[model samples]
Structures are given as C-alpha cells and as structure tokens.
Target: MVETGRIRVAKDKADLVKSLISTDGATGPFQTFADAIAFAAALGAKHNRRVPLGEISKREPSPIRLEYFASMGHDCVIKLLAITETKDIKILSLTEESEAKRNLIFEEYANGGLEILQNELRGAVDYSERILLMLCPEREQQEQQNEEFDLSKFLS
Candidate 1:
C-alpha cells in the first residue's frame, strides 16, 4: 500500500486534482474525462486495495454529468462526473467536501471560538486522511471482496 505522510482535506476541485496528480505514478495533469477516471481508479487501487467499481457501474449510462454522494458527516460529500459508454467507463473528476469545512473551522479558531473550533480541528485532520486512504485502490478491492469488513474492531 502507498503510504503518504498525511492526507489533507482538499478545499476545492482544483486542490483535489492537484493532490491526485501529486501522488506517485500519476502521469501528467488529468484534464479530461478519461484521465480523471483512470487516475481515481489507480489511486483507489493503490491505497485501498479496491476501487469503487460497483458504484461506478450502477450509475445510469449516459453522457457525463456531476453526481454527489453523502458520507458520514454532513460536511463530507463525494462528488464525481461519470462518463459511460458501451465499452468504456470514465470519471472526469472526484472530490470531497471536507476541505471546505476544514477552512470554516480554521476560521472559527482564528475568530476565538476556541471550544467548538478545537473539537472540529481535532477530527478534521484524521477524517481527511481517512478519506484519502479510502480512495486507495487496495482498500476498494478489499471492500468489494469482503462485504463484512468490520470497523468496530479497529475502532475499539
């Protein structure tokens, strides 16, 4: 598995794109529909041992379009643009919303809301890292193979 020091939550599409590109083995800037999908799949495979192939396959086959999926936290959202064809599958872009929230929390901390700001900051870093790790291909593969991957043990 690819081990990066720490994953920072991406603040926008541009930042997310930059991080994905910065990963080892990513070639050139991913600027097209095909490039983004290929990169996401590769990144997913590298870190997570799995990719969200099932999620991609279940989408309606049609022209490319942006879609969003909600995650555990209200601030966490997965966004993607899917391109589907009879023989080819592609995702133009994929990003999460936690970075925006991270910024807000940072602002709050700066503004003297120490209590709430501290709590938010505590989880933001780890949450963002987990999001990135979850994108790893190895993780995705493992998830697809075992429906019963337990989290409780790890948590406890």
Candidate 2:
C-alpha cells in the first residue's frame, strides 16, 4: 500500500464528491469523501462499470489518502476490487506496482459510479433520501431472489 499517498477523484467528479460528503456543513449522505468513494466504487463494480481517468480528469483536490483507507478498513475493498478485476490473488502483493494497479482499478470504478450518481442525484431535494430510495429496490430484488432459491423449503 502507498501509505503516504493520496487517492484521487476525477476532476469532473470533484464537485459531486463535495456535494456527497458531509464535511463543511454539507447535508450529503456520506460523512467523508473516502466513504463516498468506497460506496461509488462498490456501486460501479456492481454495474461492471470502470471508467479510466484521463489526463485532464486526474488533477488537483485529490480526496483521501492511502493511510486513511487502511485506517478506515476500506483497504479490504481495494484488495477485493483488485483481485476480482485481475482474477488473481497475486494482485494483492505488497508492492508499489501492485498498489498502483489497485488504486487505478478503484479510481476508475469510482469515476463510473460517480457518473451514475450524478445523473441519479440531479435535481433531487435530499441526497440521503435519494440514496435510500436507490437502495430499497436492490434490497427488495435480492430478498425476492433469496426466496426463489430457498431449496430447503422445496425439499420439505
């Protein structure tokens, strides 16, 4: 892990991060930019969307640090994403190159997820409620799927 370095958000999505984080008296759903990024990365991975950051998109106002991710226990998410993307556990090797690869995968997924969120949150009155509304359907569908796959009941 690159302990001393920062994790960056795409320049295009920086404003979106600000809108979603709770710092500076913002009423966003997440308490910190790292939280939002982790959520976005998961969202993007769920949708299988990974958008690489262009030269123009990787700029100033980089959000969280590598240490913050480890401290907050989000490093597991990074490792999971990296391993899933490469389909090899070796991607989790403790080396600078491996860490860079992990961060790149994370950043791209986050960018894609942020794009989805931007469209979803546009013109919303409250971000927290909007996020909850987004999650409800997914949970319902998952529950329905679970009920459909209850094979023990069928056996009985």
Candidate 3:
C-alpha cells in the first residue's frame, strides 16, 4: 500500500506536468518553457529525486518544442536550461516564439470574449497538456489526432 501510494503520487505529478505544458491562452500568457521546467524540477525535488537532465540533453528535441518554449518565455527557458545543465540533466531546444506572438495566442484563446469562460477553462486544460509534450520531446508519444481538435477525444 505504501508503494502504491507513491506510484499514485508519481502519476499525479506526471499528469500535473502534462497539464502545465499544454495549457494555452490568456488566463495569462501560456506558461513559459522555463516555468514548465521549473515546475517539473520542483515536482521531482519534492520527491527527493532529480530529473535526468544530462540524459535528456543528449537527445535532440523537436524544433516545435524549441519554438514553443521560446514563445512561452525566453528568459524562463534560459534559466531552466542552465539548471538542467547544472543538474546533469539533458536539455533540448523546443519551440521558440516571440512575446508578441505569444500574446496573440492568448488573444485567440480569449476569443469567446468572456461569454464562454467556463467552456474555455476546459480547453485551457487540454492546451496545457499539449504544450507540456511539446517542451518535453522525450515524453512525446504517437497518438491519433482527434477530429477538429476534439477535447473529449483527446482527453478520453
């Protein structure tokens, strides 16, 4: 039961990481890649373990990942990278986007114009998951795309 509890906690942590990564739109600017990394690191640290940054760095992450990270927030990305290096975890470049572009993304996310804020919250969760995978290339898995970006399908 103790081991099961630990496993459950780890799974929850992983899910939280996924959510942080894929969140999108204007609840605020999408979390920067740095934020995502820090969140992940904190989660690991809380468990008294460190992420395998050295191993992750050795693998080349996809360009989309670099662009996404850069877009989320460049400064955060740099800090995360430095931390990863110090921790001997592998670091990979993901998506890189400018502040302007990232704000535009938030604008689009707010498009329902406040009428559908509740509905938008659900979408935001899905977006967070997608973004997380985008930053952590090693976590990418081959899954079928849903029709019209269907959240039910993706989340299911």
Candidate 4:
C-alpha cells in the first residue's frame, strides 16, 4: 500500500482488477445485454478507456470474456461464440478465451503476466474450442453507386 496525503492506494492494476471481479466487489462494466446496449448508445456512461470491462456471456453457463475495447466499440463484435469440444484448423479469429470461461478473467500483471496466463491456459485445455461465426443476415443485392473502399490496398 502506498500513501498519498494519507490515502492509500494499491500499487498494481492486477490488484484493482482482482478486487473488482471478486464476489461482493464492484459490479462489472455491464450488468446485462440491455445495459450494455444502452451504455453503447451513450458512448460509455459507466466505463471509460482506462478501465477494461469484464463481461460474461449471457448464454446459459455464462462464460466470462475480458473486453479490450470500449462499449461503443463492442458494436462490431460478433455476439454468438460457438464453443466446441475439438479445435478445427480452418477457423479465423479463433483463440483461447481462457482456461475456463465461467468466472474467467485476465488481469494486468507485471512481469510476463500474459505469458503466464497463456501458459496456464495452454496446459489446462482440450477443454473447449471457441469460434466466431459470421452472420450476415442481409439478402444479396446489386452493387450500389457508392465507391467501394477496398482495404486490400493497405495490406501490401
């Protein structure tokens, strides 16, 4: 504990994230999907850039996901994540969510924190595979008059 004019502060980000995720601790970035949507609409009223939100999926069994992006940024995120028992090589955007999604969390740590977390997850699994499936519900239509902004040009 560090003292600042008599007010003490935890010396680490992990400490902060730890306290927040604990039961009876502060509530997370979103309480529910509707709350998330409303926060997104308001450009993040409860959370900010400095704080990373720990969001648990609302699906039955409710797996936790550490959000790297802000509320409004979550608008482009694919909602439904398919958890499979086996890993398929043909998938993109596929990465281990965590050792166990239920009550899972990734806290900021000093000294190879991410490496430790990834290593922990690496050895603990064969548990489940998480995949992102694209859902473009729009019907096929003819090309419009608007100019297409091709991102491929930036790749080279």
Candidate 5:
C-alpha cells in the first residue's frame, strides 16, 4: 500500500476521544488514540453510519499518522472497512489513490462511530465503566445462546 499522511477524527468528537484514551494517570479503556479511533470506526460501521467531519480545531488532539495504525495492526481494519463499504475488492489495490479513498472512508465511519459513542457515553462519570456497561448486553446475549453440549444420542 502507498504511504498516506495523518488520519483525522471529527473535530467535534475530539474531547470524546480524549476521554476514552488512558494517559499517564488517567484510567480510560483505550491505551492510545489509535485504539479509540479503531473502536469508533468499528462502532460506526456496525451502526451503518458514515458522518463527515466538520471544522477541526487548530490545537490539541493531534492527527494520528498513518504509520501508527500499521504499527498497531489496524491497517487491515482500514482496508477491510473500505472494501466492505464500497463492496469492491479493487479497493485493495496498492496505489496512492486507492489508499486515500480507503482512508477517507475509514475517517467518515470513525466520525460516525464517535457520534454514537458520544451519545451513549453522555452523563457518565467513569468512561471505562460506562464502556463496559455498553458491552454487557451483547455479552449476556451470547452467554444466553451458549447452551451446554448434549451427547445423549451417542449413548445408544
């Protein structure tokens, strides 16, 4: 794949992203900004929301370099989301134009996911706990579906 520049989050969601990241003494669910972005992008893709970003602030919450995602093993997530969105395998082509398009799609989905997270996390004192709570229902549902194995017929 071609080298791209920085990946940007929606300006409006910058504060939300900050709250999700765990710093020196902070206790957030994500260890890095890239982790939070990947989560938001996945969330957006799950909800089928692709919101375009608005005016970005000049300072704070700096844009993440493309290399960070690759180093974090999130490069595949970008390519996967891009291919899924466009329903075109050609998006995987190793070219600058293709890479740019993939990044654009990923950013929009991440922005949308951030919006969803912002609404879900509102009025929360502990972000980590709140995120866990958000995940509980799905976990519970999966547990409920996991029935114990039965081998009664084998006894015949």
Candidate 6:
C-alpha cells in the first residue's frame, strides 16, 4: 500500500532542468523521467513516504536541485526535451545521452495522469491495496510544451 503524493511540474526551462537532478548531488544524473521518478521515490523513501510523480513534477524549481542544467545551454536543454518526449524512455539510462547530457534526461511521458486516476477512483478511495510503480510509459508526457523546440518532434 503506497500513498502516492503529488506531481512536480517544471514551469520554465530552469524548473524543467532542476527536475532532472538528485537532491544530494551524490548521484551522477537522472537518465530518464523514471530515474527522476526514482529520485522522487528516493526522496519519499528518505522521508518514509511515497511521493507522487504529479506532486514531484509540480514542485516549484528551487536552488536545491542545482541549476546545473542551466549551464548546459539551450542546445543541451533542447536535447534533454527530446529525450524526455522520447517514446519508451527507460527509468534508467539505456542510452549514451546520460553521460552526454550530464544525466538530466527523463524517461516516462506522463500526461498528468494523476487527475485522471483520481477521477476514476472518486467513488472508493482504497489506496492501501495499491502499489504505484515508477515506469517508463510508452506514451509521451510533458509538463508543458516548450516554445523553443521539442526534441522529439524536431528529431523525428
């Protein structure tokens, strides 16, 4: 029985970049959104709770995650977005992009599924029997569309 928290939405470029890092700066970088999800899971684990992807993604960008992504420049960020939108992006780094992007890439493409789930479960809220697994969903997920360039579309 896992208590899913909320999602963290990356508002701007900075926020999106921040979402790709681990809090402690001890690990290398998040290869996929699932790795980011694992980071969220790690965060929840550290606090003895389950943090929802929706909640984690929506969290405002803080200096805590490190503005390291900013230093990578727009070209790098574009590449990251492409990776984020990649279909079947793994929770772990299955590609060389991990080392190339400095580990700021994400895997899962969630279309803000939290609200949808909540709506379906509106009647009987039984979370105790549920176990949320962080996965690299086949679908594409993005917090918001970037005006600059979507790597997935561009590369395609």
Better of 4 and 5 by lDDT: 5
So what's the TM-score on candidate 5?
A: 0.87
Greater-TM-score candidate between 1 and 2:
2
The residue pairs found clashing in candidate 4 are none
Q: Which candidate is the best by TM-score?
A: 2
lDDT of model number 4: 0.25
Candidate 1 regions with alpha-carbon error over 4 angstroms: 1-12, 21-37, 41-84, 88-128, 135-156
Candidate 5 wrong stretches, greater than 4 Å? 1-3, 146-156
Candidate 5, residues 71-108, lDDT tens digits: the string is 99988889999999999999989888888889889888
Point out where model 4 deviates above 4 Å.
Answer: 1-38, 45-48, 53-75, 78-92, 97-156
Q: Could you estimate the TM-score for every candidate? A: 0.20, 0.88, 0.24, 0.17, 0.87, 0.22
Best of the candidates, lDDT: 5
Candidate 1: TM-score?
A: 0.20
**Deviation (Å) of 114 in candidate 1:** 32
Q: Please give the lDDT score at residue 129 for candidate 6.
A: 23
lDDT of 4 by residue, 11-100 (tens): 332332232231344443344432333223222221221122333223321222324222435322222111221233222233333222
Tens-digit lDDT track of model 1 for 6-124: 11221222333333232455433433332333344333322332211111121212112222112222112111211211122322122233333322232222122222222333445
Deviation (Å) of 155 in candidate 3: 59
Residue 154 accuracy (lDDT) in model 2: 70
Q: How close is candidate 4 to the true structure, as a TM-score?
A: 0.17
Model 2 clashing residue pairs (backbone): none
Model 3 root mean square deviation, Cα atoms: 19.7
Report how far residue 42 has shifted in candidate 5, in Å: 0.5
Give the better candidate number (1 or 6) by lDDT: 6
| Model 1 worst lDDT run, 10 consecutive residues | 77-86
| Candidate closer to the true structure by lDDT (higher is better), 2 or 5 | 5
